[model samples]
Target: MTYSLSDFGSYWAGGEVLCVTEGAPREIAFTRDARFTYDPRGDFAVNAAYVQYFVPAQAVDAPPVLLVHGGGMAGSCWETTPDGRPGWLHRLLDAGRVVHVVDLPERGRAGFAPGHLPGEPILRSMQEAWTLFRFGPAEGFADRTPFAHQQFPVDALEAFARRFVPRWQGTAHLHLAAFLAVLDRTGPALVICHSQGSETAFDAVATNPNRITGLIALEPSAFPDDPAALETCPLVIVQGDHLDSADHWRTRADRWATLADELPDARLIDTAHEVASGGSHMLMMDRHSDQVLEATLGHVRV
Candidate 1:
């Protein structure tokens, strides 16, 4: 059965409206609290990572696809396109594959506490995403000039930006534990990940290759210190344009270059080099996300 956007966002927990404004023009007086550490701050409750598993009614024998978001973002990345269109979450499900979308620990509805989670939130600015995400030139970010044929909806930048969550740097182990738990329940599956979640993907795939059948990393980094183990599982790195400079892609080239030499079995695909229509770093959210999704599905089913 096809899942609706509301169906994906229905899971809720771990917060309350402690105070509300009482006056002619009512406003939120304040919230209960953003921080929820192990040591209770006042009848606090922690939420499980919100995961929506979309399994087609006529299921394929393929392994389930686990969709993980990058830093400063939540599982909503897969829910819908900036332009109010069905995103990869729906596309993959329609392709007859089971897909699991996640809001990892301390993100979205997963719950969080500042000092308690072992690291602080790395707040991101609009310009940071604009430039870093390869939307366009630095000046264009301020002026909102998108690259020619850019897929991301400029109109939805505000909503897209809202999904940015605070990244927890020192909590890979926590993410790993959560991922492992998911795997234990789902059984071995194909793990598709983005930027920061790459770390968790590699670690999980490496430590338990039997549980993680494959990995398709999009503009990913933080590859395991030792990538040799990644060879055990099917691996593919799908990279998009580094329009600004080689700095971003250069570092990635160097890392993957080394991995390629060491493990000739691993594969890499540069979208700009192959596809007639190039994509940005946030390729999956772009207008032609299906092209990249096509490349992703090709390698995963095995």
Candidate 2:
């Protein structure tokens, strides 16, 4: 179903803007097409998460859903699929659910401060995304030889790669702070996190479980250090296909399963094992994303 601005009643955003470091006082000037000239030298605000929220005309009773994208990606990943189909954000909005999408600090709309953070930003190549995302093997990445059950719309892989952005490895703590600040604004939310974002999600909920009613992890790459901290929060862990075929994914999946087993309120959804397969790491953008999301939401009691 198509929707317009009329579908929503209001929208807003909030997050922490941190300045870990400031550039030396240097005279830097710029102009906009020579029509406007201005001096741009000042302390740069770094590691500020960008959050965009949409409130429907009639919202469901459920808590707002917080959608956090994986590493090297922005919140836009939840807005639309590479094939131009409606993503989880739109689907949730269509279902009368309030939705908040977050672009983690140091990425996307949340600009990064050069020379502020420790290490340089790492850029993900097309081949890396092809393989790391479980669409295909590393050797066959150049040829784009996706597995038989690949469901990431391989034809649009190039378009999807466009979502890739430079990500910092040492800024997890900063991202965590910004995420918590977001929760401080939207109380008692249901967080749905993907990949590295899952790490921050786990940390956020662990730090403030009362603010987060539930969490849905999408192919999470990291798990909480203390599982007991998340005992009160409802958890759902979802994984895609071919995990056993790759050590990188297999280890993480196994670790996540172990974490689920330890948590009293945690549920595991291995799409490959439970369903008819064809699910990729990018489960939200997969061919059967609608079903996947529906099933996941069914498990989220809060």
Compose the digit string of candidate 2's lDDT tens values, residues 161-261. 88898888888888898888888888889999999999999999778889999999998988887889999999999988888667887788888889889
Model 1 agreement with the true structure over 1-302: per-residue lDDT tens digits: 36333223234322333232332432342457543323223333442456767667766788888888888888888878777788888888777778888777778767686535565678788888887887777889767997776666776877778878777667777677777777776788888898888988888877788998888888786787777787677788887765445486678867765665676456777777666344777878987688888876666546
- Mark the regions of model 2 whose C-alpha exceeds 4 Å error after superposition: 2-42
Clashing pairs in 1: 72-164, 72-165, 151-287
Q: How many residue pairs clash in each candidate?
A: 3, 0
Q: How far in Å is the alpha carbon of 246 misplaced in model 2?
A: 1.5
**Per-residue error at 169 for model 1, in Å?**
2.8
Off by over 4 Å in 1: 1-48, 243-246
For candidate 1, report its TM-score: 0.82
Estimated TM-score per prediction? 0.82, 0.90
Candidate 2 global TM-score: 0.90
